[model samples]
Target: MSYDTDIFNALRHRLMTNGFEHGQKVRAEHLRLEFGCSASTIREVLFRLSTIGLVEFREQRGFRVPEQSRALIHELTHLRVLLEAEGTAMSIRRGGVAWEARLTAAHHQLSHLEMRLQSARDTAPFVDLWFDAERHFHETLISACGSDALRDTHQQIYCRFRQQLMIEDRAFDFISENIRHHQQILDAAMAGDEALTRQKIHDHLARHLITDAQVEPA
Candidate 1:
């Protein structure tokens, strides 16, 4: 890959993982230092981000993380629910011992990552680790769903929802509750309890809609 492409991918991944906080602007000079890129390279990356609806660019205003509407959040949440519930159900039906082993391993690694994030001495490091762990945890849950198309769509929805979610201080109150919800879903899936598993999945997405609305600007 070209240097600019590599930088663009890295920046996009960071935004996806950490949720591009509103007003966290990246200037050309800053990008030059951070990615060892020239001004043109930085502009190219910013343009790519804009093309993807991830940010907005304006003269003098620089690049701004776009704010999503409540309606959009609602729509995304429903889509995620549909995708994940079906995927989880399919996995429950088709997944074998290997899937279970993967699930267990993912959970264990996530637990360690969460602990490190919570007790980290530095805030920036905590944020990075938290986002990484969150992604891995969800990826694990849906990994054995057995349909590449389904998994791709599921991940796309997750990345978009998470970008909006990480824009603010979503860590303090709701994260623990979310972890609990995930645990319940995992337990239901592991036990082959399809109904309870689906319910948990629905509830999880419903909660995302509510939380996104609450945190977003009026």
Candidate 2:
């Protein structure tokens, strides 16, 4: 990978995982010294991230991570439910055995980590592993749907959704419920029941919706 691409990805991950605080000014100088790159290179990377809604640029203030919003989280949750449910349904119709195998494997890994985390005194050690596993499971849900555009859009939104909740999610208070939700999703998918899979996906993320009435896949 190219140096600039490396820096961009590192910054993207830091932004997504709460490496930098929300609404904090991105210090290009510090990054330049740390990355051993030029100021303009960092600027280019920040601008690229800005296009994806991971970072925001103000005319005089330069770049900063976007602040969290409850309304935004609700909207993101709704979109996630719609896209994930549709994608899983499409996968069920077209994925065959290969997709099922992949989804099962993904869930196994996530489930193992969650089970261990559920009883851990300190969740710090499992956080990164859990993030990767959780993302892998969800991404595998849509991987065989035969729509790159859908996958790309879902990925962008997923990252933003994680970014908004990174601080809140680190507490691990919801891990137990998440375990049940993920198992239900896995079982529904394995059974090749599209409607049930859709419902399970919605249930997994319903808390983030925070609306008066819970939304289901349409």
Candidate 3:
């Protein structure tokens, strides 16, 4: 638990769950107890997070979560949908029987993990499991798309979006609805229904989240 990169990531993950809200200083003493990190190490990690725009560091106020712009989030999500959809189509066309089998297995695994994680009390471990499963399921479906660069880019954007989602003002109802959407996409993909699969994925991604409840006037 001492000052280590893993500890930094753990703290970052926890902060993410709490909305990564800006303007809340992370005092050295508090971080020392929270992550068991030394002041120097904590400062270094804060510097790194600041570089990524994940944290905002003030000269006199220590650190706080960065405030992300809605416009930026929208742009990233749109690019992700375009890249992922194209990759998925390519994967469907180029993927062989083995690829299909892997995708199916990954989807099954994700479904099982998601169900268990939903009911668990200590949700942290389940959150990690769910993240893994979700990534695996998406990767397996698009692994045969023939471009490692494209896949890597898709993955980076996906990870960033997932981080953004962690900070969004989402309701429990949204979570349940998303789970069902995942199931629908999985079903369509498994059946090799290209048109339906694309349509479902588009619908899943295009569900506007611009409700006033989520947006606050600045």
Best by TM-score: 2
lDDT of 1 by residue, 149-210 (tens): 98977876776677666654356356566667768877998899988988998986675565
Candidate 2 Cα misplacement greater than 4 A, ranges: 213-218
In the range 118-208, model 3's lDDT, one tens digit per residue, is 6666666566667677778877767988999989778657655665666553433355666787788878876877777777777776754
Candidate 1 local lDDT, residue 178: 65
Candidate 2 weakest ten by summed lDDT: 209-218
TM-score winner between candidates 2 and 3: 2
By lDDT, the better pick of 1 and 3 is 1
Model 1 scores a TM of: 0.74
Error of 3 at 198 (Å): 2.0
All candidates: TM-score: 0.74, 0.94, 0.66
Q: RMSD, model 2, all Cα superposed?
A: 3.3
- Residues 90-130, model 2: lDDT tens digits: 99999999999999999999999999998899889898899
The whole-model C-alpha lDDT of candidate 2 against the native structure comes to 0.90
Choose 1 or 2, whichever is better by TM-score: 2
What ordering of candidates by TM-score runs from best to worst? Answer: 2, 1, 3
Name the lDDT of candidate 3: 0.70
